[model samples]
Target: MSKKVIELDALEQINLDAAGIDIGAESIYVAVPPGRDTESVKEFPTFTADLQRTAEWLKKCKISTVAMESTGVLWVPIYEILEHHGFEVFLVNTYHLKNVQGRKTDVLDCQWIQQLHTYGLLKASFRPPEEIVEIRGYVRHRDTLVKYRSAHIQHMQKALNLMNLKLVNVLSDITGVTGMKIIRAIIDGERDPYVLANFRNKLCKKDEEEIAKSLEGYYRPEQVFVLKQSVEQYDFYEKQIQEVDQQLESLYKKYDPPDEDNYKNRKKHKPRKNQAHFDLGDSLYRMAGVDLTKIDGVDALIAQKVLSEIGTDMSKWPTVKHFTSWLKLCPNNKVTGGKVIQTGTQKTKNRATTALRIAAFSLSHNNKSALGSFYRRIKARNGPSEAITATAHKIAKIIYFMLRDKTDYYDLGENYYQEKFREILIKKLHKQAANFGYYLEPYNMAIPLVS
Candidate 1:
């Protein structure tokens, strides 16, 4: 028997001018096409001047495009510099680079990336427009501050507990109007429980007498000190969050203003807890060209968060399905031998998905909306987790179409949804009965039974 040799054709070079970069904290590895220079691969320091030199060398090699892994924040500077130099930058996800079989090193990684880019095998990750990116930065920072503030609020609660105070048990939130006033008075050296309770707001559910009893506690000096410091820290973060809200407001103003007539008849909704002090509904409406809050269970805060993550551009996704798949809200089924082996949504840290899920969960409190009815129906069939994912997926599709077409959301009401669902159930029953050689009929049409 003769041994046959196999020959494979090389992949077509789609991006001849492509280069690759492996970014590091203090250094960067760059790779260009062979023969572009004496050394096709080189290492450059990550300093600003050195990054500028790296760009110049790539330009000298006639490279017009670059591919790099979205490593931590280390890749950000290089990506920006390359983009500033007018080079087409592809911020490829690191997971996509893990499929190649080989010993992994910085030099080899850059070479592999370059090879992939030459063959047009890499897909760029989605990044919103620059303006949206700016808004995202501020929004993310605000979220961090909010988290910090929450920590201090817990600290205040711990101090109160140590002092044997039951203020939290009396008031819904210690940071609310009545709670804050009483807390400030306590910090200001007011030791009389009745005097502190005098600061109670009119809207407080508990009577002044009850509040006074809750305030009568063993206020140890050490615990009071902790409480004072925690209050100060919480106030500091609150100020910082307000500043971020101001920045967001400024950014929103840069977008085309919304038509006043559209909001003329809009119902006013009080801001939810920890929501921005500014008019987030109006700002988001102006920026997105659609009132996302009109969707059932989506409030101004949820809409703002989703918009900040995905921006106003729905063109990034080709269709609604693509949008939900990117969010990992839809099930990803894996099959083998024509049998599905796995089915579930991919785990993701996508903030937009989280916001949508929160919006979906909020529907449980609203039984009159169509989305609320749909959520309940799903929850009955599956568990709460599955229900939340399905509802979030549905909401995501609605948002995609709304943003893409710049249309308003109109709820058909829960009654309409229930009737439609009933019709669907009837159709399914009829089909099943026919398959079993039986027929489904109205009760009035059924044969009478003898006693």
Candidate 2:
């Protein structure tokens, strides 16, 4: 009963005595044969220290292939270390190993993982090279900083509102040329909203003298200070965002990943141009459905975050649902006797999912999008949380096709679903009516098949 679940029979030519190591934040537990199953599990400090020493110990034990669970982002360093030691490392999902009651422990986890590795029941999770990972990290960090800045801006806006400043009523963006000038003056101790209004762009139709006169307002000194601080923080984050953009430009040039123009360019263009199209290590930017800007509020940083979280090799998945399920975006099922079931969605949503949801929320207001329509559809049916997830799932599927197939994406337009809406409604109605004994005749009156 114990046999290898081989993917390719050709791989039968290769020798395997694969080991498994369950890595935890606190420690690492490795499993091997010819030792007390659970007792032989070797524990090591989960740090950069003694990485070489660990490799040496593994070498002495003659361990070749290794498998480990993906424990958040912590698994990366260990994976890199293991890979450097000339061992075939398989980064796997925890879901693959179903631990029963009274059968789970650090040692047992390692043993179970090892058994899978030996039997080839494990598949390596998609991992781009270190440079791509580095690129992704920078991009994701930049997005976090952007969100932080936006939050600060919102807080500042609330402070301004509480101060009875009607500046927002007059100006489109408080950070705009005229508004900033007026805000700066106020923060620098000017007590008048009228003065801020007067700071509007020279092109403003509002009379400056009259605006300045109306800007007068009673504002708390403490509130002004808090607003000023928030504005200053927001500015600081803005500066950081620009710096991150500069950093991203370099990564974009480095790993262009596959896409429509990229593939065509690769085939038609020379090596010099091809180098420009894909990353030196791996071209993640060029992957399928890599809009890099499709989801609402997803800038370069967010684009990098989504692509980096799940690489472009979608063929590894049977479908977009499979990919999303792997990301733990779907329900985890517990079934008995194939009749009754306990089902609930994944308790932990991924970081990428959070980022996507945030972007989807921002997209709700964007009328220039298929994404907006998708958002509205889900939001109408469920709630904001489910809507966000639905949009994110749609995005994930899009990304899967875009990267894996190296295709181009264009928004189908907001009316896309609407255009086909009647057809969809009719089909659903037909199904329901059929069960209720209300048969629907074909619009064209059923034509006989010309067999």
Candidate 3:
């Protein structure tokens, strides 16, 4: 038997001017295409000056593009530096670099990344425009503060429990006006249940007498101290959140069109529960050039979140399919022998995707919007979870069209959509009858008068 020899095909280098870096906290490993320089692979210390020097070195080597893994927060500074230095930076997810088979090292990873990028095999992750990124940072920090406030609320509840106070049981929100007033009075040495009940808000569902009974507890000094601190911390976070909202509003004004009257005639969407305290609807409408909140199930907060993650530039995605794929709302099809073996959506940490899913879930209880009808139709066959994902995917497509066209969403009501679908079903039924050599006609039940 003759030994067989196999030839490996070489991939054409499409980006001859590309370079890649294996970034780290303490140092970075940089690589360029072969023969680019005497020292193709070099290590640079992780410092501002060193990063500048690295950029200078890449420029000297005639490198125009740079690729790097999304290595935690370490890649951010270098990415900005490279971007500032007029180099196109591709921040690739680490998962894409995993398919390169070899003994992996920092040096090898840079080489592999450079090789892959040269062949245009890697894709850069979607990052919103720079201005939106700044707003995103503030919004994300505000979310943390809000979560921290919730933790304090839980702490207050625990302290009340330890002191045998049933305030939470009587009040819907322990952080609301009534609960806070009673808690402040308790911490201020007002031990009488009747006096604490006197501070309850009139709108609270529980009667003042019943609230007085709930407030009666063996109040211990230690738990009371904890309760006081919790309330103070919650109050501090609330003030901080207020400041963040102000900052967001101010930042948002930068994009407000000089002619606010353009949106004055636009239909106003009802504010969502726990929506941002500021008037984000008008700003978002102006910025997006469309009112996304008009879409059923999409509230002001969710609209803001989706826009922040995706920006107002729908041009980044050429089509609705591409947009949904990037959002990880579409199915990832794996085929074997020309048959699909697995079909599932890519699991993502994208906040926009999460917000869309939540919005879709909310539509499960609604029967008015076309989207809600579609959700129920899907939910009938698949479970609620799959229905939510599918409905969110549809919403993603609607959003793509609305943003790309800069047009307001005009929903065809659920009744209209269902009627159209019913017509299509009737046509299909007629075709089936014809195939069986039978004619089909509309049936009406009416009796002729026998006068």
Cα deviation of 305 in candidate 3 (Å)?
1.2
Could you give candidate 1's per-residue lDDT for residues 126-163 as a string of tens digits?
Answer: 98888888999998898899999999999999999888
Candidate with the larger TM-score of 2 and 3:
3
Best by TM-score: 1
Candidate 2 lDDT tens digits, 1-451 = 4655866654331325667777777888777754534345677787688555666667777788888888888888878888988988888867655532236675678887777677666777767666667767876786588679878878777877887776666666666677678777888887755556656788765677656654566678987888889888988987787777667566566544555553443312112210221232223344333454543445543555666676555676888788888766666788876654786567655667776766678778855677887788778888788887777777777767777775656667778767677689889999999999898977664676668
Instruction: Name the runs in model 3 displaced over 4 angstroms.
Output: 1-10, 258-262, 265-274, 447-451
Cα lDDT tens digits, model 3, 323-441, are 99999999899998779999999899999999999989989985598999989988998989899999999999989998898777878989988998899999999999999999897
Q: Which ten residues in a row are the worst by lDDT in model 1?
A: 263-272
Point out the worst 10-residue segment of candidate 2 by lDDT. 267-276
Better of 2 and 3 by lDDT: 3
lDDT of each: 0.90, 0.68, 0.88
TM-score of model 3 vs. true structure: 0.92
lDDT for model 1, please: 0.90
Q: Pick out the ten consecutive residues of candidate 3 with the lowest summed lDDT.
A: 258-267
